[model samples]
Target: MYQLAPNIELLFTEAGDYHDRVRAAAAAGFSSVEMWGPTGVDAPSTPKDLPALKAALEETGTTLEAQLAEPRTQFMIPPWDHSEFFRKLDEGVEIARELGTPRIVVGSGTGFGGWKRQVQLDKLIEIYQKAIAQIDGSGVTLVLEPVNVRVDHPGSLLDRTSEAVYVARGVDSPSFGVLYDIYHSAVEGEDMRAELAGAGDLIRYVQLADAPGRGEPGAGSIDWVERLGWLRASGYDGPIGLEYYPTIESAASVRHIVEVAARA
Candidate 1:
């Protein structure tokens, strides 16, 4: 959470491959950059095969901020598949260990068909609680983000920071918490400043993108400075993950993001 070492995935336009985009981020003066989970490894980021990737990170001075993770396929359409669920969780933990990444995101996926609503919710909560324990003290936190169900992530379990906050409270462990994404809040018609101000404690990481286009902060209607000012004011001394797809070059938007959010 140290000022969100920038993630290069956002800058990936239709222009080039992910590797080239990462190189571009390094050239643009970022000391540390974030790469996607499975994409971090050259071909496959297995335990035995990650040394080369480590070399690459050492070479570029880029660190893995957090991974989007392998998705919730097992939980997505569950006949309540605990077997597949725990298996992927184990794999994800191994992958995180290999990458030296401190964070991995886990999603509480949609209905497993024919299950009652409360049943699904309880199941999800139970699974996440166990998952939290599985990754305990691994130097990694399984960050659960709240998305905008109205548009992008329909049927998403963790759709509000409040909900995420609740889950974090239930799990009640340092290994589990919420990764607050600002763009989703804006789209959901939340007062960005107020939300963070109220629940900053439960949040472990914070990301930004402006609504309407999920682009850079200043590019959209979000008052980047004012909102970020609140974070600093509220004692959020963590990385503010820049998970935006700028309508321009990736590095081109960094300075603007920093400057604008600096209240400059």
Candidate 2:
């Protein structure tokens, strides 16, 4: 069975703070959870009490599947300066170490206006290669995410799974790979099987939500069984983060996917 790590930022909100959400998710019988940023540098994701969050994880025996890299890297603009992103990476990795998180989700922010798409993609290769070198042997893998331009993230540079796969290939490091978000892919209308086949082993992490609405699995048109089957066929044996807004209570929101994923 595939392990499902609910996004504490969106799920279990009734439990109070971030640390309390961890305990709440564990109480709901989830063994793992995922979250947004650690230091709250990114908006919509408040700063977390790292020590308290770590204690809660330990107390519940829950694994932190992943966390977002701070200061979202928007590389394509004219005055492109990535100093802060590089500087804070060590801090992000340290927080990950404290929480025992193995993967950090990185993104290619809004498109660099006036730059050719191919050139922008190549630039990502250079950036991540340096990042991998910096974080080498840290035991923290950086998973590049391609957000959809259609619904959630407009004008984002990396929106296609194939492009993310290309960047991963260019980086060519064991420490870097792709994070295939099912909701984003579905929103972009990519063929699930074809994309997964193209991605192959480079897909180091996965996340899901119903497309058209970005709600819990059952709230959209995606065929959970078929999608999960394609994921299984692609040989991805990793945790699938429940990164969606809950339309109902937290526990009730997960029931559909839990039942469907059990057999998947």
Candidate 3:
């Protein structure tokens, strides 16, 4: 069975604060969870009480599979000042260490308008290479997520999994890899098996919501059985993050995926 980690930012909100959500997830029988931004620099995600969050995770014996890097970087924009991103990365690493989180999810913000697509992608490699160096030996794996531009993240630079793989290959660090988000891939209309085959082991992390509405697994048209089978066949044995919005109650929302994943 594939281990599943519901996104705390979207799941278990009924339980109260971020730390309380962690406790709620554990009460609902989840031993793992993921979240966006530690300091709440990004919108839609609020600042977290790191110490309390750490305490809750320890109390629940829950593993924080991943958390997003703060102030999501925008490399393509002109006069590109990435100093803030680099500066906060150290802080992010320290927070991850305290929380016992394993991976930090990164993304390619909206593309630079004037540059060639190849140039922009190569730029990403250069940036992440420097990022990996900045936090060298921090025991943190940085996973680059390729978001879909179709329905969500319309101007995102890294929309294709293949392009992300290319960037990862260029970065060439064991600590650097890709976050193959199933919802984004499906929304972009890429062949899952082929992309997974191409990505191989560079897929350091995974997240999913359903396309059409970015809802829970069974809330959309995806064939969870076939998709999960392809994911299994791809040899990625990582925890899948349920980054979906629940149309139903949070506890009830996960039942479909929990059942499907057990058989997958």
52-105 in candidate 3: lDDT tens per residue? 999999999999999998887676555778888899999999999989999999
Could you give candidate 2's per-residue lDDT for residues 11-75 as a string of tens digits? 99999999999999999889999999998888999999999999999999999999999887777
Worst 10 residues of 3 by lDDT: 72-81
Order the candidates by lDDT, highest first: 2, 3, 1
Q: Name the runs in model 1 displaced over 4 angstroms.
A: 12-20, 39-52, 73-76, 111-120, 262-264
Q: For candidate 2, what is the lDDT? A: 0.93
Q: For residue 264, give model 2's deviation from the true position in Å.
A: 1.1
User: How much lDDT does each candidate structure score?
Assistant: 0.67, 0.93, 0.92
Clashes of each: 6, 1, 1
Give the CA lDDT, 0 to 100, for residue 256 in model 1: 71
Q: What is the lDDT of candidate 1?
A: 0.67
**Superposed model 2: Cα runs more than 4 Å off:** none
Write down the TM-score of every candidate. 0.84, 0.98, 0.98
Residue 191 accuracy (lDDT) in model 3: 99
Lowest lDDT 10-residue stretch of candidate 2: 72-81
- For model 1, give the RMSD to the true fold: 3.8
